[model samples]
Target: MIKLVIIGSGNVAQHLIQAFAKSKEIKVSQVFSRQKETIIPLLDSSKITTNFNDLIEADIYIIAVSDDAISKVSSQLPFENRLVVHTSGSVPIESLDNKNKRGIFYPLQTFTKGKDVDFSLIPICLESENDSDFDLLEKVAKTISNNVFKSNEKQRKALHISAVFVNNFVNEMYRIGNEICEENKVPFEILKPLILETVNKVMTLSPKEAQTGPAKRNDMQTIEAHLDFLSNKNHATIYKILTQSIQNNGKEL
Candidate 1:
């Protein structure tokens, strides 16, 4: 079994612990957290600790903390020349402290508390300085995910930015839709099926092919109506910008 140590107690860390703890091929040796109380919900109290010196020897040490905290946390690790990896999309592999074998284990998924994540569907992006370590990361990744990818720093960074546009920005659009629904005294649940269908359509169709609605048709009247309907200045501006983008993309076809 591949012995692994996980650091941090946030959403990514908790999800990693949940997934790895159940995997047959990987063993979670220990989890380090700043506060035992915080991580107690996800891990056994006995296996979770506040002291780094108390950390056991494991095959891989995954630092799942925030991007800004990665360097500081890795630098503080007491060990050296071990397989130390960070689960960050944008942070480069070189960001890890030079004392150890550096690698990245980025799971391209939006992790939220209380939401169940199907590890099999989430793509695990792996990168490492050493070829052997890359294989090691892949081995651990495959235990949880069928979709494992080997990506370089530039490619991973670009993927992260694309994730922001597709996941983060799209989620913001959903929020705006929900806001409009609430303002009109309609249940946001009414749009759930449509949202699900739109996502499903994109799975089989190119985004351009999947495109529909007034913007795609260049219905200026409908676009103006939407902008007017969004009384909030920021919301109106966002609608205008996205509508412009959609029509511009349509023009390309």
Candidate 2:
């Protein structure tokens, strides 16, 4: 059985703790959190430690902390030469302390506290210093997820940037849309079906091929109407930039 010791009680760490709890082939030996109470509800109190020195030796020590705290936390570990990995998308493997073997176990998904995610569907991006450690990470990843990938630092960096555009930036656009709806006293639910349809289209069709709306059609009248309708300067600016990008991309076709 692959034994893991997860350190941190944040969103990613808590979700991992819950997922590993259900795994028959992998065991979470212990969890280290600054506040033991944060972990107690997720794990047995006996298995949660407030002190780093109390960390038990496990096959892998997963440091699921903030990007800035990774190096500091790894440096504080009482043991070395053991497999240590972090669950960060943008942070590189070298951000880890040299006291231990470094690797990355980034889960490419946005996590929120108290929200349940199907761990089996989340893609786990793995990278290690050597083949042996990578094999171990992959084994652990496959235990809870069917979508596992071996990603190098460069590829991982690019994937992370793409995720920000697709997930983060897209969400911001939704917020802007919601704001416009509210200003006009319209129910935001009115856009739900259109949103769902747009998402479904991208599954089988490329985003460029799936594109629609005034921007894609180059309808200057409709585009100008939208710009005039948007009273928020920031919103208008963003709309103009995105419209220009879509038109530019369409030209390439």
Candidate 3:
């Protein structure tokens, strides 16, 4: 069995620890967190400590700390020969500053505490400096996910950007729709089916092909009416910008 230790006790750390615990080939030997309370629930009988020197011997140390604290925590760790990996997508693998075997085991999905993750559907992006280390990382990833990709630092950075655009920006659009519904006294829940359908359609059709709106159809009258209906200046600005962008794409609105 490959021994593993997880550092940090945030949402990402919690999700990873729970997932790794279920794998037969992987053994979670210890968990470390700066705060005693944060590590309480996850680290039952396992070796749990706040001090880095108390870390148990393991083949791999997974650091799931905040983006800024990765380097600092890594520098304090006592082990030198063991493989060290971080879970941040934006942070480069080199940030660990370890001369020993190092790599990134970034799970390309948003993690939330108390929420169960469908590990099989999540993409695991692996990167390493050496061939041996890459193989080791890939093996661990494949245990949980079928969708594994070898992405370099540059590629991972680009994917992170695209992720923010798709997930974050789409959520903002939902928020705008909710606000509109609230003002008009319409039930926001009524849009649930349509919202789900929109996502479902995009899976089978290109986003351009699935696009539907007055803007796509060049319905200038409807666009103008929608903009006029929106009392908020920010909403009006967003509508105008999106309308122009959709029109430029040449999708039959």
Candidate 4:
């Protein structure tokens, strides 16, 4: 079995601990959380540590900390020259201290606390300095996920930016829709099917091809109606900007 040590107790770390727990090929030999209580429910108390000095030997040390803390955490590792990887989508692998072999094991998905995710479907993006380290990282990734890609730093950054558009920005649109529904006393659930259809269409069709809306059709009448309906100035501004972008084929205004 491949021994692994996870550092951190955040959403990604907790989710990874759960995913790896179900994999027979990989063992979470240890987990480091400053407050041991945070990760106590995920693993045996014997396997949890509060100090970097208490970390046991493992084939790989996975740093699942915040992006800003990655460099600081890696620098504090008591050992040198072991495989160290972070679970950041945008942060480059070079952020890791040079004391150990550095790599990235970014899972390209949104993680939320108290939600269970199927790791098998989530895309795992791996990058490493050497071929051997990459092989090992790939092996561990495959145990939990079927979709794995070898991504370089530039490609990973681009993927992350695209993710922000698709996941983050798209969610913001959903929030705005929900707000509008609530203000008008409409059931937000009524739009769930339409939302599903929108997502499903994009699966098989290009986003441009799947586009269908007043904005896409250049229906200024409906567009103006929507703007006039939105009482929130911020919401109206956003609606106008997005409508113009769609009509202009996403040209910068």
lDDT of each: 0.92, 0.93, 0.88, 0.95
Candidate 4's residue-wise lDDT over 1-253, tens digit each? 9999999999999999999999999999999999889898999999999999999999999999999999999999999999999999888888999989999999999999999999999999999999999999999999999999999999999999999999999999999999999999999999999999999999999999999999988888998898888899999999988887788886666
In candidate 2, stretches whose alpha carbon ends up further than 4 angstroms from where it belongs are 250-253
- Evaluated against the true structure, the overall lDDT of model 2 is 0.93
Query: Candidate 1 clash total?
Result: 0
Of candidate 4, the 10-residue stretch with the lowest lDDT total is 244-253
TM-score of model 1 vs. true structure:
0.96
Q: Could you give candidate 1's per-residue lDDT for residues 1-253 as a string of tens digits?
A: 9999999999999999999977999999899999788888877789998999999999999999999999999999998989999999999888899999999999999999899999988999999997999999999999999999999999999999999999999999999899889999999999999999999999999988999999888888888887777789999888788888887883554
The clash numbers for all candidates, in the given order, read 0, 0, 2, 0
Worst 10 residues of 2 by lDDT: 244-253
- Per-prediction TM-score: 0.96, 0.97, 0.93, 0.97
Q: Judge candidate 3 at residue 40 and give its lDDT.
A: 74
lDDT score for residue 4 of model 1? 94
Model 2 lDDT tens row, 1-253: 8899999999999999999999999999999999888888899999999999899989999999998999899889988899999999888888888889989999999999999999999999999999999999999999999999999988999999999999999999899899999999999999999989999999999998999999989999999998998899999999999999999993654
C-alpha lDDT of candidate 1 relative to the true structure: 0.92
Better of 1 and 4 by TM-score: 4
* Candidate 3, lDDT over the whole model: 0.88
* True lDDT of residue 144, candidate 1: 91
